[model samples]
Target chain A: MTFSDITIHAMAERVITYTGYMARWQPDARERLERAAFDLFVEQGFASTTVPQIAARAGLSTRTFFRHFADKRDALFADEHAVPDQAGRIVAEAPDGITPLQIVASGFDAVAAAQFSREKSYYIARHQIIQSDDGLRERQLHTQAALVEALRSGFVQRGSDPVDALLAAHLTATVFSVSIGRWLSAESTEPLATLLRDTFDRMLRTAAS
Target chain B: MTFSDITIHAMAERVITYTGYMARWQPDARERLERAAFDLFVEQGFASTTVPQIAARAGLSTRTFFRHFADKRDALFADEHAVPDQAGRIVAEAPDGITPLQIVASGFDAVAAAQFSREKSYYIARHQIIQSDDGLRERQLHTQAALVEALRSGFVQRGSDPVDALLAAHLTATVFSVSIGRWLSAESTEPLATLLRDTFDRMLRTAAS
Candidate 1:
């Protein structure tokens, strides 16, 4: 081949490699931002931490940090949106015969499996940071409200009555909150899904009684 | 009668009249503040209303407003703390044979009777103002959390298991929220107590099913 042909081929190969790198870069940046922000939040407090410091720790630009998170607080809840989606999908795909309450419990199980199973220490740290700040706590409450709304909509779309759907959604959110509180406590050793299921059963028994 | 006896009797009558006026003034100030704040909030959104404006509209000093509420937004929830107190009292006074769920439902019924029954339009307006503001919404959620904690503690004090108490508390909060939502909806004509009873029955059925 001619020298010009060889040069053009190498440049084309470099362009293809650069495109692949760009494709992977966004998620990597988000992960790095979350890790750095969490470390800072734990070391200092959530209120004391800054976006620029997080970006500096993550070896990213401030612009990149903004691209990933709306603010430092948002970094702590990076996966907040995924929770409702996971729960809703599980409810939507459950078998036809299950009660609405059961469907919601299964959704909680699915969320625990998909989002919370592996990040034990991370979640514990995040919980501490969130609990320490009023703003973070409010954001967490908002997130749960969104999840409950998603669960309610999921039940409604599946043909459950509206009030039943609302009750089941609220109940599921309550059980999830209780299970997570237990799971995050230093005294608990059980898996979150197990805790969720147990809480659900207890709630049912309490209601029935 | 002696001159000294006539003077003492006059002094006693003046003290009684002044005491009666003092007793009425505190609640009158609070009611005026709440009415002023609600009117301002409805006229020009919650965010746009100021504490001074609310106080001025009430024909009271800002100091009096502060004495009644911690802030302008607090005027909207002046009765929020009374809810848990009323509910807790009901739970504590319930009969021995009553289940935890039944006790809680009864507590909710009592609160509906004492607070919500007489303030339909006021609550409807307050709900609109709260819905329009994120900060107010967060406060409302925090208030609910506090109520849940109060309910849980009440159940625990009455010798229930901790987890069961938590579940019962959460379930009660859920039903209360649902009932309030239904009662406040534009299409609903049922009383809040009827909605609470209906919701509690539905929840029990849903759980048992």
Candidate 2:
């Protein structure tokens, strides 16, 4: 909360922004590319948009665009490395006595708390685009599979059994699905984290019953 | 248990054979393809083999080969769908009092038991081939993701929470990793089901502790 603490936190975030393997581009470049890609995808459909057109729209060279992303398909999903570390750190910092699943859910809750309210429209649009394309759906699955691996490894490092590690991964992923659905319902105004917590609470009740 | 039951099971196995999903001329076509693919993969390498060479060596036309598989890669990996239905059936038949995770582990046990006693060399070859190919590895990950979806859906239908369903799918998959590793290392002929059960037991103990 001190000015020094704030400065240190900003420096840490900036370091992660550069050093994170999941980060494919500088923030400004990513934002521009995302805006260009989303507009083209929505206007002409994802399948029809060529990489050249996306590059042109973003005002970046085709080579530069490739430098930022391995390929056009890579842009369809969020970076896996960025999400998992944040999620894992949140889960790891939770109360130790909670069940592994609960710990994992708390991580998802942290993600939801930080991103959902600010980017509701972007989330809705992105979800629609992904749903419309089989390739994108598969890519989404791949992203999710990576997230699970990251989370499971985190749990295993914490001395959990492989099964509990996997359970934590999957349970956290479910919280993701549930929160996304509830977020898109246009009926809930609560923070995304609260929706996730409620989802987990409901599951625990069901299991207890 | 009856003569009729044995007859029907044999007939179904015969149907699988006639479908040319396995090789046609070789009585051990499945075994031959697995060995040949693994050998070529280890020696000449996976990228070098053409469909024609695999067909000629197997003593079949490329058309007959296509009757069995969509591509050469398809022959290398085992069919996942071949087991999930049986697994879901086995899980569904378990005692109602068992937890969802227990039911899933039981299903994993049934499938693993069926696969564990097979030729160790074949597995080693397959593992080598897959490890050397990134595209193949991605395909395998996609297959596992599909399996997770199937398992989670089954749990969801049984009135479990979405989170619990996902957790069950992942936990079962983790036990699968443990069971497979344990099965491969043993000199004694322990049942795969027993291995899976032991893994699950250890996981539960770890969670409780």
Return the top candidate by TM-score: 1
Who wins the lDDT comparison?
1
Q: What is the lDDT of residue A168 in candidate 2?
A: 53
lDDT of 2 at B180: 61
Could you give candidate 2's per-residue lDDT for residues A83-143 as a string of tens digits? 7767677656767666667566546545765655457777778888887876677677667
Per-residue lDDT of candidate 2, residues B1-209 (tens digit): 66755654454445444545444345665555555555666777888776555654554455655666777788776564655566566655777676777677556645765654477666666766876776677666666667667777877777776666765665566566656666666363666677777777665543343
After best superposition, candidate 1 residue B129: deviation in angstroms?
Answer: 0.6
Per-residue lDDT of A8 in model 1: 43
